[model samples]
Target: MMPTIVFGVLSVIIIGFALAMVLSKNLVHSAIFMAATFVGVAGIYLTLSAGFLAAVQILIYVGAISILMVFGVMLTRRGDISASNLFNKRIISGVVVSAALFIILGRLILTSEWFPSSFSVPESTVGPIADLMMNAYVIPFETAALILLAAMVGAIILAKGARRTR
Candidate 1:
């Protein structure tokens, strides 16, 4: 009963924040809402007994990605993050595409056969995951980190260049 209530609350939060992120005019506000959506996803991961994934969601999505988005918005010299016009000429085509996607996804979800797992939840997953990351996946992990670092550096350079041009 308690878990159900928690799940319902988290679901509501996730959906609400996602909608807020999409509908918000201010880019900074959208980024903040996206962070909130990420937090709600972390909570969902926790409810599913995937603590490591929850931590990763919070750390990567909320901590790093959302902060990057906010910084990008801040560094821009635009008068306001808000769109001048909410609905453009392409709005009709966009809505049609979105509706088509929704119908396709809904059909897939309803038709999919989900398996019921018989195995119990593991006691600890962090240690084994850490070992795998350090041993087998170290190279790929480091490469990903370097890529993110390079992207950040590139963004900084571009911002500086824009300022110089101004």
Candidate 2:
């Protein structure tokens, strides 16, 4: 009962903030709402016993993406944000497509019979998983960092280019 209540609250908060993000006229406010939505998702992860995923979600989404979006908005826009009619042409189409996908996935989930794992992972396995990620997956992790670095550098160069042209 407690779990259901917690999940229900988290779901409501997540959906509310997602709607707020979409409807917000102010870019900064939308970014804030996006962060709130991300945090709410992390809470949901926590409720599901995915502590590592929750930590990563908070670290990456709230720490990185939220800041990056705000910086992008600040860099690109001037003056108060206004509601956009950008979705006018394709809104119905998008909704139809998304609803179709949702229905298909819901059907798959409902029809599938999932079996529980036979073996339980020891608490001690967590440390080894972390170690493996830090060591074996270090290259991919560093590559991701490099990609972020490249993006930052590209943004800087583009900003400088724009300033010089002005």
Candidate with top lDDT is 1
Clashes of 2: 0
lDDT of 1 by residue, 1-166 (tens): 9999999999999989997887676778889999999999999999988899899999999999999988877875377557722445676788799899989998999999999688887888688788878899999989999999999999899988988998
Model 2 C-alpha lDDT per residue in residues 1-166, reported as the tens digit of each score: 9999999999999999997887676777889899999999999988766677788999999999999988988877866556431344666787799789989998999999999668765555357667877999999988989999999999899989999999
Clashing residue pairs in candidate 2, if any?
Answer: none
Estimated TM-score for each candidate? 0.76, 0.74
Off by over 4 Å in 2: 84-89, 115-126
Off by over 4 Å in 1: 1-9, 81-89, 116-119, 164-166
Total colliding residue pairs, candidate 1:
0
Q: What does the lDDT read for residue 111 in candidate 1?
A: 100
Q: Candidate 2: deviation at residue 43, Å?
A: 0.6
| Model 2 TM-score, 2 decimals | 0.74
The 0-to-1 C-alpha lDDT of every candidate, in the order given, reads 0.88, 0.85
